[model samples]
Target chain A: MARKIDPDQREQHKAAIAEAVWRLVARSGLEAVSLREVAGEAGVSVGRVQHYFGTKDALLLYGLRLAQQRMEGRIRRRIAGLVAPGAEDVLRATLAELLGDDPDTRQAVRVWTAFLGRALDDRAIAEALFADDVELRAFTTEVVGSPLDAHGLWALANGLAAEVACGQTTAADARAVVDHHLDRLLGSPDR
Target chain B: MARKIDPDQREQHKAAIAEAVWRLVARSGLEAVSLREVAGEAGVSVGRVQHYFGTKDALLLYGLRLAQQRMEGRIRRRIAGLVAPGAEDVLRATLAELLGDDPDTRQAVRVWTAFLGRALDDRAIAEALFADDVELRAFTTEVVGSPLDAHGLWALANGLAAEVACGQTTAADARAVVDHHLDRLLGSPDR
Candidate 1:
């Protein structure tokens, strides 16, 4: 006889699985994740993992999307509260918060970094991230007033994230770079 | 009884193993590597992997160190021929070369991005990268001036790499960003 499962319970189970996947990735890197491993970590059967995610790649892809949306939501909320800062200042604040070492932000960083390598082969994720990157770089250029021909903002943003991920520099330092770039963009002493 | 192996032949085999390690990591990822798998890739026995690396972690750590050294050597070679370029110019050239999409450079980048996720959990690789990253950022700061702090430089480099890795931006765009950032560093007219 097939056992009826509760919808809410299933949703809760999926969330638990994602959380477990995140924890495992954080502790051991994304390569360390496996269906059996995730199922065991989440205290669920392998059948549950299959039912929820279909496959390991599906789980990973879903996890990646979850991470992206969560991050976008965080930034949107922070941007909502910026009140009256200049476009550059708002950008700096937004960037600082995104790269800062808060708990949730740190988890996102780990997940982002973990998936970055795999994105080289995952066309779907690569396409999405690439589009998002283009938009982000354009927004940065508009706010900072840097008349970069193309890929300028993206490079700057990339360099900053790599440094932060490597612990070679701090969030404050990243903000300072944004401010300096903004100053150049504004071409004014006040800036 | 174990067959008697020549020391020189043994050293050659170790080198071969390390080379294959990077290739596998670049083509797939660190997770795809295992002692037996690497041995097969290198046309050697599993016992040879154990003999050379002692353990999987040791092999990974060694491969990571070699990868960084390979990158540093490439960057140094690129910068060696450069002359009369100011700090910003130096940085632009250095960064452009580092992030270039040439086959060799791309291989290095692939190995780098893949290993970094593993490094997060492997203390040995983490410590080594941390040191290397500091030196790289410091050099970048020296070229970019005070306003473009190390962390900012780091993030910009990282973001650019990610952008390129995901094909959101072209190598030409990456060069453009480096050039613009250099111009800003040199206090040139904005845009």
Candidate 2:
């Protein structure tokens, strides 16, 4: 009889592997990530990890995509809880999410930064990363209204995230800076 | 008879080593920076490299500090050339220098980013890097005046630098954004 393969089980395994990769990235630099180390960290066989992700490039790409999706999902959930979310609220929430205050967000930022360093050389990653930047710019432009370009807004948010991640600025201070910028770009924050 | 070490030649050798490390970092990520590779790139013996900088940590630290000094020196020269440099002029010039459009500034930013990633795990580097941040904050605060905190300004500059380095935005675009922010903070750019 053929063995049964459960879809949920497979996803859980992939997520575990990704999580392990992220931990390694957070602990060491991106260079520390390898199939052997990831498998060891994830407590799985190297063949199993290879089965799930064919190549290190694919694994890394999946990890990057996963981090982006997790951040987007988080922003969506936060906005959903708002009684009546406005454009400014959406913008504020999105920037705040990128600040990477909490553990999950912090890990995501680490993974993102690692990939960014790599993207400097890898054309494919650069293209994908730039696409994300374009999407961010569009969303920021829509929410903030005219006179505020997405490039500037994106830079400000990312700069804040980098500072927060590097311990140069506290999470609260970063949030305050973002809020101040928002207030300047938009009107005074409601309430 | 023991050969006497000339001060100027020692300085030149160290600068060459640092430059090689910067090139390695710019081409690959921080992990590419090993004593063997650096010595090979610098066209010097590993023993000579170690004689100047004892370990990989010291080598990396020296490279980072050198990059910072080069940037500061460039900014100082630019500011000195201005007939009558105002606060806005100083702020604009400092930010433009960080944008990494030129070859020198581009290499500096790349090395700085690599050090930053490593600084995440290295306590000594983190402390030194934070000190640099503090110094930058003080300088920005002095130039920008009140109502604009140094932390926010630093984040904006770094964010812009990261974006420019990652190819998400052009150097000219980053400069415009900085000027726009300056106008908002301190009145419109004078002359």
Residue B93 C-alpha lDDT in model 1? 61
Q: Top model by lDDT, which number?
A: 2
True contacts kept of each: 0.63, 0.42
Q: Which portions of model 1 show Cα errors greater than 4 Å?
A: A1-12, A84-90, A128-131, A146-150, A165-168, A176-180, A183-191, B1-11, B83-92, B147-150, B187-191
Give the DockQ (C-alpha) for candidate 1. 0.49
Report fnat, model 2: 0.42
In the order shown, the candidates' DockQ scores are: 0.49, 0.51
lDDT of 1 by residue, A8-119 (tens): 9877778788888888887788867989999889898999999988988788877777777777888777777877667666566566666676777767777777777777
Please report, as a residue range, the 10-residue window in candidate 2 chain A with the lowest summed lDDT: A144-153
Give the docking tier of candidate 1: medium
lDDT of 2 by residue, B1-191 (tens): 89887899988999999999999998886767789999999999999999999988888888877877888899888788888887668777777778746789987776666666666567777776666776667777787664335667677778777667766767788788877777777778754
Please write out the lDDT profile of model 1 over residues B26-68, one tens digit for every residue: 7777768888789999998999889888999888777777767
Instruction: State the weakest 10-residue window (summed lDDT) of model 2 chain B.
Output: B144-153
Tell me the TM-score of chain B in each candidate: 0.82, 0.90
